[model samples]
Target: MNFALGFKTTMGESGSMEALEKQLICPICLEMFTKPVVILPCQHNLCRKCASDVFQASNPLWQTRGSTTVSTGGRFRCPSCRHEVVLDRHGVFGLQRNLLVENIIDIYKQESKRPLQPKAEQQQLMCEEHEEEKINIYCLTCETPTCSMCKVFGAHKNCEVAPLQTIYNRQKTELGDGIAILVAGNDRVQAVISQMEDVCRTIEVRITEVHLPKAQL
Candidate 1:
């Protein structure tokens, strides 16, 4: 089962936290998976709504005349691996719900809501050549972190330098904007999932009232 983590910037081991958060995001929606997540036959997990969207786009006439049944029997490609997913009469609902992944999302949400604990001061990154100096500047020309000594007389002496704090703040803003876009995409996928859930409910009721009783006879 595929799972993605949703993370907010906080103090302590920033690099590891960022990498962990990236793993939790859905490849299709590029956001945390919404409820009713499903696992494909190929073993990848996608938000049910996102999967439904992919299916509908591939088979435009699948929902024609309000019918859930696919007459011609077509398949949709997986967004990540591009593996073909064959559709049954129930379509997306036929795929299994990934209980493990859903539970992880629930746990992540609970943890994220809690207040962050105070962390110890992080160690400064040191320059290779001038081990005594902390890296405080970014060499724009070489696109690498450097110390003041490097800027003054080392390899980056001719390169333009910017304060590391300035670059950090800019990157933080860009990450925030990216998260916003992903959230917006998730909202759209949620709507599609809702529609598919309604369709599945209708199909289940029909089966119970019509097919089951006739079979018992």
Candidate 2:
């Protein structure tokens, strides 16, 4: 049986969104897998960013200026099973994307947006790939929130994604700390500016004193 078919069969029997969502989580981040999820030789999935971070940790000398673009090939162990994943010169970018998981994430997000209702109000959603069959499992979106603005138009049209979990929180926290550092530096700059203004004032006073009229020729 095909991998997707087998999974779908299991999903049908389990009929639990919570259980399905649990599998979508990345082991390293412990959050839902973000875009461009990669599959290791061990068959475990990871977000590309997480994979790059792990790869860099394993090969710090190859890390560039905060980007995953690597100059040489290296290897990193899968966080799930510790299976070594060898990379080419392209680094994590060279890894094959798990498109099946990406598609599943899209479906998961769509299901998350719809409100739960009685069977009478419930509408069946058919998968684009498997149009003949209604989407497996019942909708249990009451616990999840939906955003109307996400699908409207403009820049947010393609803005659909699982709520920022692992990467976003970490980046935001790092950003908050960075803001504090910038604020402290700005305080030093303001003090320097005040001192410069004081020097100008003293220079003006010295010039006035030198210009004072004297009895001597």
TM-score leader: 1
Per-residue CA lDDT of candidate 1, range 60-157, in tens?
77763465354655689988899999977687877899997888677666655566554555568889999999999999999988999999999999
Candidate 2 residue-wise lDDT at 94: 84
Q: What's every prediction's RMSD, in angstroms?
A: 26.7, 20.9
- The superposed Cα distance between candidate 2 and the true structure at residue 209, in angstroms, equals 99
Question: What is the per-residue lDDT of model 2 for residues 1-217, given as tens digits with 9 covering 90 to 100?
Answer: 7764554445542246678889899888899999999998899999999998999899887755566554678998888888888888778888999998998888776665655434544565554434454433221233222333322432234444344244457669999999999999999999999999999999998888788888531
- On a 0 to 100 scale, what is the lDDT of residue 49 in model 2? 96
TM-score of each: 0.48, 0.46
By lDDT, the best candidate is 1
Badly placed stretches (over 4 Å) of model 2 are 1-15, 64-71, 119-217
Error of 2 at 115 (Å): 2.5
* Residue pairs in clash, model 2: none
Q: What's model 2's overall lDDT?
A: 0.72
> What TM-score does model 2 achieve against the real structure?
0.46
